[model samples]
Target chain A: MFIQQLINGLTLGSIYALIALGYTMVYGVLLMINFAHSEIFMIGAYIGLWALTAIPAFASFTITGFIITFLVVLLFSGLLAVSVEKLAYKPLRQAPRLSPLISAIGVSIVLQNLIMLFVSNQSMPLPEFKTTRYQIFSAEVDTLQIFIFCFSIALMLLLNLFISKTKFGKAMRATAHSHSVSQLMGINSSSMIAMVFFIGGALGGIAGMLNGMYYGSIKYNMGFFPGIKAFTAAVLGGIGNVKGAMLGGFLLGLIETFSAGYISSQNKDVITFCVLILMLVFKPTGILGENVTEKV
Target chain B: MYKLISVLFLGLILIAGCAKQDKNVIKVALAGPLTGDIAAMGQGMKKAIEIAVEEANQSGVLKDKKFQAVIFDDRADPKEAVSVANQIVSDPQIYGIVGHLNSGCSIPASQIYAKYNLVIITPASTNPKLTQQGLKNVFRVCTTDDVQGSAAANYVIDKLKIKNVSIIHDKTPYGQGIAENFKATFENRKDKVLSYDGINTGDKDFKALLTKIKTFKPQLIYFGGVYSEYGLLSKQAKELGLNAVFFSDDGSSSPEYIKIAGSASEGNYVSMIGIPPAKLKKAKAFLDTFASKYPGTDLQPYDTYTYETSKILIDAIVKTNMDKSKIADYLATVKFDGILGITSFDANGDTLNKSISIYKAKNGKFEYCE
Candidate 1:
């Protein structure tokens, strides 16, 4: 039972990591929390649902089908993120902090309602992706769990390489440190900002699609709670730090599933948020957050 | 500034002047969850009421009065139900109301209806407290959860011969009320309940809870919740190899439940307060007419009750002077044998001779189990 719970935790955690990376990446680059990223996750999930329903060859579970779904969701989400940043966030780039925050919230509402109006408000049971369970060490683990863990890890590693080993990655880091400084260093800061939004959106989108596949259901407001939890993961790991976000997502997921299994199932959500509150209060800089002086 | 103010004042006057009123129109409101998870049930009820009204209007029940069906989507929320109740009450043209399904919504909204002397006949809400609150303005065509719960318990314990039964509710009034009633019946009969628990509405994940239930090794898992929650619960339980015989309440008697739960829902039982639509011999013509008129709408059990309720209200309006108190008084004493096999309400506004029909899921459909 405990091992089974851990598998559930790992599957849930990896999805959270996918979304948390988005929140962390956006905060990393623009020093702005893209609140609408969760809605982008929802859009991706809807797209994944439609895709599943449309494709006859991918009716049941296959690794190739899953890969196709992930890639499709990733591309669409990246494009959506870039478009959102260009239209809503860029206009308020020089405004007060509250202004951009309000704009992000507006974007979130518009996206959620638009989907509600066009698609359905009910929970859509995504087309089944069947997999056989294997008995291992007094526990049963399924192919879906294994796939989620590996896929999330692979994406995270790919993202790490992109950020560290590529010129675009260096520009993103440099911009995060100080936007004007990176601009002076000949980086097209606007396009760099858009790129950061795209990557964050893409990761969050894939996370949403993965979430639909994992749970077998998706609703209009499905992203709200996971979005808050992922944001909590971002904060717990260190808001501006990508590595911290990944660690925080897994830790939170494990904590949630174990507590639900061992403790009260109804109060699992309460316990999760309590952990977030305690971490926020005790370690404000998060596990990997570094202190930096203001450049005023 | 003076010219702009004059323009705004003229626009307000124009809006006020355009408010249309027809003296011969008799409006009856139908409020329920037109959107959200349980939308299919609400929409089914709506179509039945609309059909009932259209037939009556064409037949000239009131001779000169033309009936208009006013619909409102309360989304099965208590707060929204109250707001909808208030909205319909404020509309003086509305003669009666047919619903606000889901007892959680109907119970709260019933208070506001009583205050304004508005008549509301709920077709599907089964919570016992709804009619027991002594609200004369409120009536229901279906049996209460107390009756339903007892029937289901008797069927499970005595007939099915299930001993170690587990009870789970969705924590809402509709879910929790029926669950409590089921537990009460079990306690009276001295039947063993292995475990009793609750889950929140909108909860899709049930693996953690299912894993916990596995330790108990319950012979029967009786869930008092709607289809959306139970669909996931049953599927997850199957996935975890719990292997318990599943029993659900009327809340999960829909074909959608089987579709959502897939192969896992096969051979499960669902107990509803009334006989299954397929079994109602008197309702076959009504069902055929409904299906022919509305090509795609599934003729569900609640649609029968809604059809009966609409006919009753229309019949009452034809006799009464379009007064709320008169209609209420008439409804209390009225006896009719229509779609639901001799419909009549007791002093508490609950239907007399309540019967619970059991259904078994097979081949992605709910089949009546006689």
Candidate 2:
């Protein structure tokens, strides 16, 4: 039972980690939280739905259609995220930090209303994905759970590779460490920021797709709860630390599942939040986060 | 320019005066949770009312009179319900109301509706206290939690012959009331209630309660909660390797539960008011019409109720000679054969006879349990 909950927690945590990456990545470079990231996540789910419904190839392939639909949705979502940053976030980059944050909130509201205008506020039906369960000594696990955990780990590994091996990744790290120094080093900080948003948005899109598939339905406002939880996960793992966000997501997911199982199921949210509050009060740097010293 | 402006202003005044004098149209207000967690029910209700109004208008039951339904989305909040009620009351054209879905919202909103002397027929609000206030204007088409609770308890005790049961509630007015009523009914039948507890609505975990429940070795667990918590509870219970009959109330009517819990929802029973969409003959027609009108939308619970409420309201309006003052009196005596069933308001304007249907999840579908 414990192992089963652990697996379920990890699967859920992976999706949160994917979303949290978007938040932490953007914050790492811009020092601004994109409040509209949740909306981006929501749009991704809609795009996935649209792709599945509109594409003839995907429509006919009932069993394997979801995987194809997910990829198409992820691509579109990444493009949308990049475009949003270029149009909405880029113009306000030179302005005060508060300006971008406010604009992000405005963008979030607009996207939500736009969804309401187009999609019925009702929950959309998800294309069925058959999941086979494998029982192992009092624990029954499903294929979807394994897929989620493996896919998330692979994405994170690839992301780590991109950040470490690629020029853009180095530029991002440099920009995060010191923007002026990175600029002096001839890195295009603005373009790097855009790239960060693109990467984060792509991962967020994947997370959105996985969430819809896992939950078997999607709502226009579904992004709010999971997005907030992912943000909390990012903070828990260690904001600005790539590995920390992943750790935080899994940790939170495990904590939530266990809490739901052993503690009062009704107070699961309370328990999760309490853990976050305790962490913040005690170990502010988080499990994998480095304690930073400010020299004035 | 000034002379033209003066002429335009005079024309507007004349039009306004003429519009005010014309009493050919009557408006009915529909208030419910349209944009929150329970937004689906509100939307279903709204769609039903829309269809009912359209059918009534087409039927031309009221000679030379038009009926309009003004919808107010309360988002299931009591505070918003009051504001919505006030808005509905201020509108002189509105003769009747058909909403405030949640009991918490309905209880407070009913006062304002009653004070304004507007007859409010709730299609979905099922709390007993909603009508027990003895408010003349407040009427409900659906049976209250009292009937539903007793029905579920009786089923568990008589049919299932379950000796030990665990009762869990979501801690809301509807959930807690249903739980308490069920507990009383079960206790009355000499059935042992192994455990009784309350949980928050949005809670995702149930292992602790399940652990306790497992230890108690109850044959059945009755959850008085909405679909959201029930889905997770069902899933977690299965994951924890606990096999027991899980039952929920009307709030778990949504197909979303099956989607969320997957195979885990199998064998779980949900007792709900009115016939499920699959069983209602008129519901099929409504579904067809709704599908054609609003394509690619999932059918939701309370859609038939809303349709019936609107039909009843229109029937009352037509019978009352289009007089807003007499509409409430007419509604009290009106018998409406609507999409759900033949709905008639008693002295308290509550539906006289209503049946609760039990649906069991089987093979990833909600199959009607006989």
Top lDDT prediction, candidate number: 1
TM-scores for the candidates: 0.93, 0.84
Off by over 4 Å in 2: A48-71, A283-296, B1-23, B55-62, B166-168, B192-221, B227-243, B254-267, B275-300, B315-349, B361-370
lDDT of all predictions: 0.84, 0.81
Interface RMSD of each: 2.1, 3.9
- lDDT by residue (B239-259, candidate 2, tens digit) is 556788899998887887887
Task: Compute the lDDT of residue A59 as modeled in candidate 1.
Answer: 58
- Model 1, range A1-296, lDDT digits (tens) per residue? 87778877888889888899999888877778889988999999988887667886665546687668778888998999999998998999999988878899999999998888888766677877767888877566777779889989999999988888898888888888888988999998888888888899998898888888777778787778789889988888888888888998998898887777778776777888898888878887887776333100
Candidate 1: which docking quality band? acceptable
- Deviation (Å) of A72 in candidate 2: 3.2
What DockQ do you compute for every candidate structure? 0.47, 0.23
- Looking at model 2, the pairs that clash are A260-B205, A260-B206, A260-B207, A261-B207, A261-B208, A262-B208, A265-B205
